[model samples]
Target: MIRPATREEYPHLVDIWLRASRQAHPFIDEACWRARADDMALRRLPACEVQVLEAGRRVIGFYAMHDDHLEALFVDPEVQSFGHGSGLMAHAMTGHSSITLWVYSRNVRAVSFYRRLGFSIVDEREDPETGEPESLMAWSR
Candidate 1:
């Protein structure tokens, strides 16, 4: 079932981010992980607005939406490739005509996932800070 997440979930969410450290480009240092965690932790999110993918009482994944844009999506590694990410995305799209997101070019898994969801690359540009290349993708309902 999908439901809202409580404040207590932040730590677990941070842990998930750590687990996904593999998402960073190859040859990247741990500083990138720390920076990601710091940024995500300090991010301002609307209260009670995070959507969680839960099974009974256990939270298996989470996603956040900022207006029509999907700001974040994370599924536990143990449950990845089991439709958790797709389910979260579909849930987020229910009320929106379209969604846009940025995927790091080196993150092959996410690029493929977004493509499979019918999100096409609308633009390609370098990330200003890290100078990493990224693709901007959009999906229209």
Candidate 2:
């Protein structure tokens, strides 16, 4: 099931974000993700509209959106490659005619996934925080 995330699930969401980040963005230092955990829970996740995918009462994935932009999408490493990410993306797209997101260029898997979902790379630039090349992607009806 997918629903709006409750405050009580922030910790679990952060755990999924951290684990998935580590797996998806191996080029970035793990410490970077660890240091951002608190910010994710306290600031980022709360600042966005977050929806979680639950399985058997446990959160397995989530997506965060701010207006028409998709800020984050993550699935627990243990439960990845099982369509959770696609499910979250589909849910995120339900009420919007268009959506935008930024993704690290080196994360080829993610870029490909978004492309398969109809998001096209509209721009490319460096991520200020990590100095990594990133692509700006968008999808529209």
Candidate 3:
């Protein structure tokens, strides 16, 4: 079930991020790690703006939205093919005209998932701060 994320859920969110990053980029230095929540507190949106997908007592996925852009959407790798990401994306689009998101150019699975959701590759640019080329993708309502 999807619901607003509580303060108590923050730790779990951080854990999921760290675990996913380890598998996604095993050699990265811990000091260089950055996840969506790094700036979430400064987004100025209500805390409830982000939704958490809870399967019983565990949080399997979550997504944060601001305006027409989806700031973050991640599912635990252990359950990647089970449609949690798609479900979150669909929910984010329900009341917005379009949503923009960035995906790593090398994450083929995620790139394909966004493409299957009708998000087109809009552009690509290097993140000035991180020096990583991010694929900017967007989808219209």
Candidate 4:
């Protein structure tokens, strides 16, 4: 089940984000993700429309969106590869004619996953915060 995230669930969502971010972005320093956890919980997540994917009573995945831009999509590392990510993506796409997101160019798995979901690479640039090359991808209904 996917639903709007409650304020009480912010910590849990942050945990999922940290774990998944570390796993999927091995090329980046783990410390970077750790340093961003508090901001994710206190600022970033709240700034977006966040949704959580629950399995039974546990949150297994989530996506954060602002307008038509997808800011984040994460699945708990232990529960990944079981279609949770795709499910979250599908849910995020509903009611929007188009969506856009940025992904680290070195994160091949995520790049391929977005491609499979029909997102085309529209731009490429360096992320100033992380100094990492990233791609801008877009999908339209």
Candidate 5:
């Protein structure tokens, strides 16, 4: 089931984000994601609109948004390919003219996932955080 996450569930979202990011971008050092998990738990999750998918009270995936920008979408690496990602995308598309997100260009798993959901790259740039090439993608209603 999918629903707005409770304050207590935010930590689970962070775990999902960290695990999925590591799984999707194995080229990036695992330590990087581990380093970011604290910020995600303490700052980002509280500041964004977060939704989670649960299976009998266990959080398996989540997506975060700021206005029409998709800040993050992640599923537990152990439970991927079971429609959680697509379910999150469909939920995000409602009541918006468009949604935009940035993904590392080399993270082909993420890029392909977004493309399959109708997002197309509209711009390309180097991510200031990691100095890595990235793409800005958008999906218009």
Candidate 6:
């Protein structure tokens, strides 16, 4: 089930973000993820509108968005390919006519996932933080 993330679940959500980020972004240095984990926990997640996918009592995935821009979407690596991401994405798009996000170009799986969901690549640029290529994608209702 998808629902708004609760403040009490913040730590779990941060752990998921770190784990997913480390697992999916191999091309990037691991230390980078470790460093940002704190920021994601204390800053990003709290600042965004986040929704979580819960399976009974456990949170398996989540997506964070602000306005029409999706800032984060992370699913536990153990639960990938099980439609949790798709579920959260559908929920995220509920009240918005359009949504936009940035994905690392080298994260092929994520790029494909977004593509399959009808989000088209609208631009490409280097991510300043990691100095890696990234693509901007958008889906319009």
C-alpha RMSD by candidate, in order: 2.0, 0.7, 2.7, 0.7, 1.1, 0.8
Q: In candidate 3, where is summed lDDT lowest over 10 consecutive residues?
A: 39-48
lDDT of 4 by residue, 99-140 (tens): 999999999999999999999999999999899999999999
Give one digit per residue, the lDDT tens place, for model 2 in 1-141. 999999999999999999999999999999999999999999999999999999999889999999999999999999889899999999999978999999999999999999999999999999988899999999999
What TM-score against the true fold does each predicted structure earn? 0.88, 0.98, 0.83, 0.97, 0.94, 0.97
Name the TM-score of candidate 1. 0.88
| lDDT values for all models | 0.79, 0.95, 0.75, 0.93, 0.87, 0.92
lDDT digits (tens) for residues 1-112 of candidate 5: 8888998887777877887888888778888889899889888888889988888878898888989898898989998988888988898888578999999999987899
Stretches of candidate 5 exceeding 4 Å from the true structure: none
lDDT of 6 by residue, 1-141 (tens): 888999889899989998999899999999998889879888988899989999988999999998899999999999998888888888888778999999999999999999999999999999999999999999998
Clashes of each: 0, 0, 0, 0, 0, 0
lDDT tens readout by residue for model 3, 41-122: 4442244368888897889988877777776787888987788888877777886788898877777777898999999999
lDDT of 6 at 106: 96
Q: Where's the lowest-lDDT run of ten residues in candidate 6?
A: 87-96
Model 4 RMSD, rounded to 1 decimal: 0.7
Error of 5 at 1 (Å): 1.5
Off by over 4 Å in 3: 26-30, 34-48
- If ranked by TM-score, best first, what sequence of candidates would result? 2, 4, 6, 5, 1, 3
Which TM-score value belongs to model 6? 0.97
Q: Kindly state the number of residue pairs that clash in model 1.
A: 0
The candidate with the higher TM-score, 3 or 6, is: 6
Error of 2 at 48 (Å): 0.9
